[model samples]
Target: MDTTQRALAVGVGAALLQALMLIAFAWPAANIAPRDLPIAVTGPQADLVVGQLAERSPGAFDVSRPADEAAARAAIEDRDVYGAIVTGDGPPRVLIASAASPAVAQQLTQIGQQLSGGPAARVDDVVAADSDDPRGTAFGAMVLPLALSGIAAGVLLGLLIPTIGGKALGLATFGVVGGLLSMEVIQGWMSLVPGPYLVLAAVAGLVSFAVSGAVVGLSAAIGRAGIGIAALTMLLVGNPFSAATSAPELLPKPWGAIGQLLPPGAAASLLRSVAFFDGAGASGPLAVLVIWAVAALTLLGVGALRTRPANEPATAAPIPVTTG
Candidate 1:
C-alpha cells in the first residue's frame, strides 16, 4: 500500500462523508409537511370551533380568534391567515382569499365543513386568482422563473469572464432576450405555466438580470472559482433550500432559516405572493431581492475596479526628441 493510495482513499472517504451530510440535511427537510399555517376563527363559538379543529387534526392548523368577521377576512387578505372560519346560524362558513393556493384553500374549506358536522358551508373567496391557475400550482409558478434565471446566470458568467468580443455580448443579449421571450410565449400562448403572461415575464426578467449580473461580477472578481461559489450559493443551496416546492414551515429549521437569505428562495417567495397569494405579505421577499441585487451590483463594481490596470500611463508618451 503506497502513501499516495492511502491519501486518495482518505480524500474519497471525506468527500463521501460531506455528501452524506448534505443529503441528510436536505432530504428530511424536503419531506416535512408545512404545519400550523395561520387560520383565523370568528364565530359565536370560535374557541370551541378552534378546539374541535385542533382535536381533529393535531398540529395542522394554528387557529387564532379574531375580533370579528371583518378581522378574520382581513387576516386572510393580509396573508396573516391561510383561511378563516366564520360561524353563522345555519352552518359554519369558510372564508379564503382567492390569492391563496387553491389546494390549501380547498383543504381548509373541506376541513372546516367537516369539523362543523358536514353541514353546508358558504365560501367567500376574496382576492380572486387568475382563472387559468390551478390548485397547488403556486410552487411551480414561483420556481420556474428562478430556474430560468439561474441558467442565464451560468451562461453569462461563462461569457463575461473571458473578455468576449462585442459580437459575443450581442449574441448573449439575444440569447437572454430570446429565452425570456420564449418562456413568455410558451407560458402565455401554450398555457405552459398558468397565470398572467406579462407578470410572469416581468418576474423572470428581473430574476435573470439580477442573477446574471451577480455571476458576472463574482467571476470577474475571482475568475473560475467565483463561478463555483456562485453555483454553490444560487443553485445548490438556494434552490433546494427554497421553500417553493414546500412551504418554509414544512422544512427543517436550518433550511427554512437559511433559505430566506438566498436569491432563488426570495424570488420564488415573492413570485408566489404575487401569483397565487395575491401579493399578500410580499414586502419581506421583495426586500430580500432588493438587498441581493444591490449587494451583487456593489460586488460587480468592486471587481471592475480591482481588474483595472493600476500602472497604465494615462497620457500619451511624448515622442523622444530626435538627436540629429
Candidate 2:
C-alpha cells in the first residue's frame, strides 16, 4: 500500500484496538454476576437455604452441603468456597472470607440478611482482608502495574540485549527486583497483603518473571511481532478476564476459568492464596505460573538454537590462494 493508504490503515487499526480494549475491560465488569460460585450451606435449614438461593439467583452459586457450621467454616478457610451459610441456630450466620473475595462476602452477607426475614443475620468474616485494603480494591489494582512493568522489561531486553542468554538473565534480575519492590509497596507500605514477607515476595517475583519471560521469549522466538502477540494475550485477554478485582466465578462463564489459565489471573489467585488463606488452594495457580515460566524458557531455547549458526566461526579460506 502507498504511504497515505498505510497511514489510514494504521489509524483504522488504532481505532479498532481502542474498541477491543474497551470491550476487554468493560465486558466483564458490566456482566459482573456470580455464575456457579461455590458457597457452603449446612444445618437443619441447609436444603431450604439452598433451594432459596437457587430460586433467587438461579445458578449463581454452587451450593455445597458441608456437614455442619464448623465444616462450613472449614470449607471457607480451605478456599473450597467463598463463604458459608449456617442455619438451624437463632439467626442465620454467614461465614465469609473477605480476603478471598470482598464482593462475594458482601453478596453472602446480603443473602444472610435476606434469610433472617427480620433482623440482619450475623455475619462473621473468617479471613478478613488487611484494613488498609479492606475491600481489596488496592490489592487488585496492583496487577496492572506489574503487567505493564513486565511488558516494558520484555521490550527493553528484546531491544537492548542482543543475545538470548543475556535477555534471560535480564528477565531473571528484573523479576526478582520487581517482586521485592512491588511487595514492599503493597505489603510493607500499603499493607495490602497479610502473608509472610518472603513467601509473598517469592510468589510475586515468580509472577513477574513469568510475564516478562513470556514476552521476551516470544519476541526472541518470533521477532518483533511476538511482542504484539504477548501484549494482546497478556493485557487484553489475561488481565481483564483475570478476575483480580473480583472472584473468577463472578465473571462470565468459561471466561473466568480461562483467565485463571493465564499469567495475570493465576498470579492474582496465587497471591490471594498466600496472602490470606495460608496458601490454601494455591496449587492450580502456582502450576499455571510455573507452566508459563517453563514455556518462556523453552521459547528462549528455541530462539537460541535458531540463531546459533549466525554466531559460529566461519570456515577458514584456502591460504594457498596467496602463494603468488
Candidate 3:
C-alpha cells in the first residue's frame, strides 16, 4: 500500500481498537465490585471481624489490623488503607477516606451497616473529595485530555526539532510549562483538584514527560506506526482501566492492576496522591513514571541509531590553510 493507504489503515485500526476497549471498560464501571480491596480493622474483635467478613464475602476485601482508630485514620490519610472498620464499641463505625475513593467509602459504610444487621453504620470521612466536585470527576476528566496533550506535544516537537537532543529538550520544556498551566486551570480556576501547587505541577510535568517520551520513542523506532501504537496503548487501553473516578479495586481483574502500570494510570494515581492523600502512595507510581521515562528515552536513542543511513559518510575534516 502507498503512504496514504497505510496511514488510513493505521487510523482505522487504531479507532477500532479504542472503540472496542471503550465498550469493554465503560460497561464495567457500573458493575464495579471490590476484589481484594484493602481496608483496615481495629479493636479487640479485629480478628473476628476479619474472619466474618471473609466468610460473608470471600475475596471482597483484603483486611489489615491497625493499632487503633487513630492509626487506621492515619493509614487512610496516607492512602495506605482505603477505609477502616472499628469494632468493639456499640454498632461498629466505618472510617472512610472518601477523597481516595467515594465508592469504596460508600461500600464499606454499607457493609458496616449490614454487619450488625441493624440501622446504618456511623460513617466517618477522614479525607473528603473537593466539595466543588465531590465525586472527584476531574481525575477522569484529566485522563483522556492529558493523553491527547501528550500526543500533540510529541507531534509538534517531532515536526519542529530535527535532532534527538532537541526533541528531548522540547519534551521536557513542554512538560514543565504544560504542567504549570494545567495547575492554573484545574486547581486555580476550577479548584476541582486540591494539592500543593508545586507538588501538583511537578507531578503533572513528570506525567507529560512520560507520555511525550513514549510517543517520541515510538515515532522514531517504528516510524508512524510507533506513534499509533503508543497512542492506542496509552489513551485507549490506559484511560478507562485507570479507574480514575473510582478506586483501582473497583476495576475488573488484571485490567485494574494493569492500568496502574501505564503512563495515564500512573499519572492519575500520582495526581490523586498529591491532591488529597498528603503525597501518600506517590512513591510507587512515581517510580513507574521514572521507569517509563528511562525506557522510552533509551528507545528513542536506539531508534535514532538504527534509522541513520548506512551510506551517510562522516563530515570531511577542514583542510589546513597553506598561506599565512
Best by TM-score: 2
Per-residue lDDT tens digits of candidate 3, residues 55-125?
Answer: 98899888889899999998888887899999886878889877888778788988998986788778888
Candidate 1 lands at a TM-score of 0.73
- Model 2 backbone overlap count: 0
Q: Could you tell me the lDDT of residue 4 within candidate 1?
A: 100
| lDDT value, candidate 3, whole model | 0.83
Candidate with best lDDT: 2
Off by over 4 Å in 1: 1-30, 53-62, 97-99, 106-110, 119-130, 138-145, 158-183, 192-200, 276-278, 310-324
Which lDDT tens digits does candidate 2 get at residues 43-72?
Answer: 998888889899999989888898988888
Shift of residue 18 alpha carbon in model 2, Å: 0.3
The TM-scores, one per candidate, come to 0.73, 0.96, 0.87
Clashing pairs in 3: none
lDDT, residue 132, candidate 1: 58
